[model samples]
Target chain A: MATQDKSSIFADIDEGEVDQEDENVDRWRRNLRLWRETLAKQWRMLTDDLMVRLAMITIAFFMIVAVFAPFIAPRGPLTRQYEGDAGIIIADWVEPSFLSSESEYLLGTTAEGFDIFSQLVYGSRAALLVGLVAAVFTAGIGTLVGLTAGYYGGKIDDTLMRIVDFLYGMPLLPTVIILVALMGPSLWNILFAIIVLQWRSTARVIRSQALSLRERPFVKAAQVAGASDWHIISRHLAPNVLPLSFLYGAFAIAWAILAEAGVSFIGLGDPNTVSWGTMLQSSRAYSALDFGAWWWFIPPGICIGLVVISGFLIGRGYEEITNPELR
Target chain B: MSDTGAPDVSDENPLLRVEGLQKHFQINEGLISSLLRATMGKEADYVHAVDGVSFELERGETLGLAGESGCGKTTTGMSLVKLHEPTDGRIEFRGMDLTESDDEELDEFRQNAQMIFQDPFESLNPRMTVYDTLAEPLRIHDIENETARIRRALEFAELQPPDHYFDQYPHELSGGQRQRVAIARALVLDPDFIVADEPVSMLDVSLRAGVLSLMERMTEEFNLSVVYISHDLSLLRHMCDRLAIMYMGEIVEKGATEDIIENPQHPYTRSLINAVPVPDPDVGRERVELAGEVGDAIDVPSGCRFHGRCSEYIGDICETDSPSLEQKAEFDDDREVSCHLYDSCGKQS
Candidate 1:
């Protein structure tokens, strides 16, 4: 079990964990032990939950496909359908291999001759990339802003919170549509569009938390200890709010994945990308759904729904973690 | 002024001298209120959390501030450390006026003063280890020898084999152990004074004595001035050399601990001592049940704040005229009381 490997050689417990005394390896080792115990407790909570297990299994499956796309895919995402006599046809809709035994095509092909199976396999990469990157940046920015607003309060709080309110007042899809339109359509642009608007929820939730946390006696003790404002925010206040940050980060992954699909379905996706959104958009060219080409369209649609729902289920599991019941 | 009549052994320079310390929090805090007050001439309101309290301490003296909760005892302690900026008053530290002290002097004051908060569970950061909590103060003050200093503080706090606790988080330790870490952190900077706001009240009763004695030992070894704030009269009587009884953001009485506990002069003080529960069930005692709750601190009583609940409410004078803190010829030379019963109050009117 992962819990048993407390001393795992590659146990990187934190990204910016303070060593306190970098020279004291014993201190580091003890901290590692402490970190493992805490992580194990959280792991138990996650594993014990049925919804969380389903979410994990689904996400794990997508992750495997995403990570091994190059090795697993039999053809490139944008490869043309090459017929026996007329090779490399761009406008031919090939039949699905299951429909005909001798047909070379697997899960058929688009009018653009792009293989549906290859594109679906590689599409997981786009979904996870946008989901993970957007979630990270969203949580990171929100946490910093929340800490500053909550710690310094008064005018800074008013100003920052007003900005957040303004962003929230903006309609999400429409604003993201405008943002993607203005920034030019690409996978990263779509990711950026999601991030620009999505950080608001994390910021609001974390800001309210930071508001209460700053009033905690520990934060005041740090102040009485002669620590600077930045030091207190980073070392004391930020760490306390991190669990809440992670919870929001999980919800944001679900939001971002769904949003990317929405933007791409509106024909604003990266033309070169093989995301489920782009696959769905391209399926419309041959009216594959009207012609009942469920193989060409339904697989990508199901992948999108499964991944997004799994993200939400995992996010629900993490909510229990942030405000865990007394053990 | 030494309101508690604590002997001034170091008379030339008392460690701390506070005069008319007041901390009032404005209740209506918003743009709408400001607009109303500006355009419509509406009056602003305040909580009057700590109003016009004053005292002085010699180096190494332990002053106990005893009052019912919300009587501003904790606010008084917090003001001592500049945790809540005084609304209107002067706090002098070693002859330096804190209200007007520049950043450099304030920083010096911050280094010299520390506070151990009430709840150990809430006082120590959960994310930080014991070693990190202790090292934070030292690091902030630019002190060296981080490891040795942390070990010594743990030892001082009576945590045996201090190294064992070096990496333990707050949640992992018992309540008593967490309070010890808090004490260790407060004293790590070697500050001249510390404000302990009910430090052990949240601990198990069995653990309170051990933590209190640890603080006492820290005081003697370091010659530290401490302001112990608690509503527990017995605990204060045990820990404080001098005691000040607060009533509605004002010090109604203060004297040597024995005098306040034994020869309480103010009617309010007398009632407070009488309220302490006796352990012996066989012993019958006459209890003075206070007629009403503590008066509203915002719209404070016009006369003596305690007159509304005073057991010996003396006629119209008690209702109309405010009394100043004065020494009666009858009470101990060290004692002072702010009550209408004192003949000195008659002279003032």
Candidate 2:
């Protein structure tokens, strides 16, 4: 009976199979160890979250579309189509249909007989361009201003912060609209309006952080070492404040996009450019809603919502890193 | 212009001499009061953090500034290095008058005289790697060949396998290790003098010895003149060649460490030595209970700051007149005592 039990155990444990299985297990363990080490080295709370990952992916999708808009779009955003040589529109406000063939238009057609899918693909480029450029300009100016004010302190700090407060207190959207109107509805004008309004929050956050950081011993040590004021600000102070500015920059990008969309919706957007907001304006102007053409307005609205939401989600992810208490 | 009363023993000039060093911080008044004072053109109330403290440090000598918590030792040390910018004082370093020096001269003084702070964690920048922290002074001084200098500093600080510590940030290092990095930063510039303000007070008791020993080794290696400030008299006795005891911003006693430890003249110095805990069970020690809390620096006593808490309080003179430090011939070394008891005797003789 003992011999029989031993033989059965041996049959189950097959010697060659066990050896192969052990080697596989060792390789698996080694890979897991490598993954864990990499995670430990580069892990950040903001980027590690599943919600943030989804947000980043959404952002990446919009960015890809924006970048490849000219190639991916089937028709020119402004191109109009006609039924025959007489130029009578046949696909005006056609509903989206997957069953339609190439000539029927995949996302149907707008009231202007322009392809809706093409308009969307082209619109992302404008939205992302304005948002990113405005954010970069605001971050640069705000960081320089805040670093100077906080590091020098006393009168400089008081004067700059008071100016920031003045700007912060103004009605953001209305001011932006007024500025955009006065400057004329060009891309740079709209960007300027957004940047002027968005920089206050960045300056305020960076200034407060710089004020405390200036008191740290390392700064004092640098001073004792006779490092010049400019050197201290550019090297020591700037690097510390950059991470925080980046966190604020993410939020600022979302704000810029929303501001641009709002201005465009109110008819201040550049007429030459195609954007989600401009698409909405055109859809409304042509009475697409009254005509029950959901494809004309709904798609643009959804794209704006998706882009803004994704920007906010990415900003939130950065927030967990900058303000670690939230994690 | 009161005489410091120290007998001039040596003709050779000291490396650094501080005379009448005073640091007074203005206490903020209420908004209404400030307006009123501004209109009246009156000066605000001030806290005399370090008031009329004077001492000299010779080359290659470690002078320990021993005192209680609020005795202004740290202030004295910081002001000596021009860190706090002495409110009023004459700091002469290596024959250069620091107070009268131009920006360039002051910068030159700063390069030669560096300070090591108390808290190791706070002293080193959290964002900086060990390499950057060590290289900052070298870079600020505009020294060439930074890479080789940083490596030498790492080894000099006794952080073996210097590469391991070069990339590590302050937070990654242990307290002892961080303090060692701070020491390395001080040494990298090869400064002739260092003001170490309670360098090991924030460290664990077990770690203090190692850090202190490393500092001692550096002192020998670098020929550094250090003003080592600490409340621990035992540590001071172990480290310092000469000891200066401060009381309420005033140096009450100054002499060789062994001479002062063996024969404490001033009542405050005697009390300080008595306060140090003795480990022997067979030997009984008299505990000198320092009376009341140290009074507010803003409201220092009229005569002597230690009079209120003194064990050997003399007569009405002790309360009426402040005593100036005087050299006594009774002791073998050039021991200076500032108690009314000794000063009155010296005056009579």
Candidate 3:
């Protein structure tokens, strides 16, 4: 079944050449199958718990609402139901249409004659946007720093870890508030603030995971195989420590959303944006709590609570899978 | 020290040659602690893991490095593959000095020399499939025909119909099967030399013979010279062509497998050979109990490293001078021992 060609001891004598096209197609199909199975398993684990399932559902609902805000929201977020003296609908202090037939606003109107329904629907976009985008950047930066620090260790670990320690020394909310104030209360500035602090937790956790991972015999085996430092970090250590990065990534989303909401509650949110934080700021200015207008403040607050809770639940699901002992 | 048992010194080149190889690990690697030591004016300490070790291997020959745990046998094996860069001395593989080798040469060295570690459970990455594990070195060295090569290597290692295991993870295989996969990974590149540090020590007794026979067959088939590091003297006698017994990071005694096992020269070697269970109650072997426990590698005994535990403590010189490994016994010209017991003890008198 074999030829005497010393060069091709592994080669099949009967098979003249390996068709690169066939090999690529075969590998592609295999990888696709593997991906499908892995995704199915992860989905099962994530949805196994009733709490986690509800959390997933909440995230899904927010995602849908955010994507379809234009159609789902009854009016433009900035549209005032009553403009100047036209005021045909008596939009000022309008109660929810469901609560009182006299009001036309679905989730009621703010004291400023704005439809709180439209603002609430449109606000989901900002929360999801800042949370997901900031989390991605945070996870990427944290994973890079952690993998490099832990794999190369010694001096590099000391430098990066000390930087993380210094960052940890800063209080999260105050630092974010000062940053947002300096950058002038924009959504992007808020996201930047959240990302700056949020990456540290991921970096610290991933660095510990990477520290233990690099010491595993597999890493030394890779070294013995003559793998470069970069190759070992990327191919071997990164994949093993990836679950920790992702776990922190899920938590970063929650942290970003909460940080943004906290800043917005304290009136540092962007004046021009339609985020839940801005909604809360606008409602709070009119003393909605004093006026018994729970609709004005409660929906955005509930939305923030649901998103953060679900983010944590989703992160816990990932942790259970990555660390079975946590299950 | 005289070199560990290699045939014919005049020969131009053997597969691998190691001389005065040493590897020391600093006790305090942390910046703050080391700085604290510097401030205190205390010299930094190190664990002399592999100290002044020398050995050579011919093509297709197996040299078993035998010693108790913590005797630096494993460290010497690691140093041989350049896994632990020598703190000093030379490791020349086919006349190429590995320690000073540039990236290209180091890369070449990596391809030509490989290692099979002690634990199969720990060595294979838990996440990687068998295919990925075997394909790692090939991908690193840019070797192509991965599937075919992996299949052949697996089959050669006797994981018959190797495709059966291509998709499985390490946990899926039995201990013996995992060791075979480890061996397959090492041999995938067709390396000229390999260091197997107790490859089967972690396997069950039933599975050990199969892996060992497979390795013995692979050595012949691939013409690969191997340095096996293990404390099991009987296993060494069964598997090795020649044997070197290390004590406190130095080669204490070395010779052909039969010479070292049949007539061990040094007190340490004798104690090691005596400890092996004979498996026969009818023929009771003499037991020789030595002195204290193995000394700390950090503060190795000044004179002969094994002098504390050596029962044949002949003279005062045993505690004062380090004896060079030489052909100390006349009857067996090949065997070497490092002990003042064989010396005239002129200074003590």
TM values, all candidates: 0.89, 0.86, 0.93
The candidate 2 chain B region of ten consecutive residues with least summed lDDT is B1-10
Candidate 1, true inter-chain contacts retained: 0.49
Candidate 2 segments exceeding 4 Å error: A1-46, A82-92, A97-103, B1-12, B28-33, B328-332, B344-349
Q: Write the per-residue lDDT of candidate 1 for residues A167-283, one digit (tens) a residue.
A: 999988889889999999999998988888988888888888888988899988988877899898889988788888888888888888888988898899999888998888878
Q: For residues B33-137, what per-residue lDDT tens digits would candidate 2 score against the true structure? A: 999999999878888989888788887899999989988998888788877878897888865678788877677677778888888888887767787788778
Stretch of 10 with least lDDT, candidate 2 chain A: A1-10
What local lDDT score does residue B248 receive in model 1, on the 0 to 100 scale? 91
Please provide, for model 3 over B14-118, each residue's C-alpha lDDT reduced to its tens digit, 9 standing for 90 to 100: 778888999999886677988898899998888999899887888779999998888899889988887787999898876668877787767777887889999
Candidate 1 matches the true fold with a TM-score of 0.89
Candidate 1 Cα RMSD (Å) = 8.0
**What fraction of native interface contacts is shared by candidate 2?**
0.34
Query: Which pairs in model 2 have colliding backbones?
Result: none
Greater TM-score among 1 and 3 belongs to 3
lDDT of 2 at B324: 85
**Candidate 1: stretches off by over 4 Å:** A1-54, A57-61, A82-91, A325-327, B1-11, B29-34, B280-286, B345-349
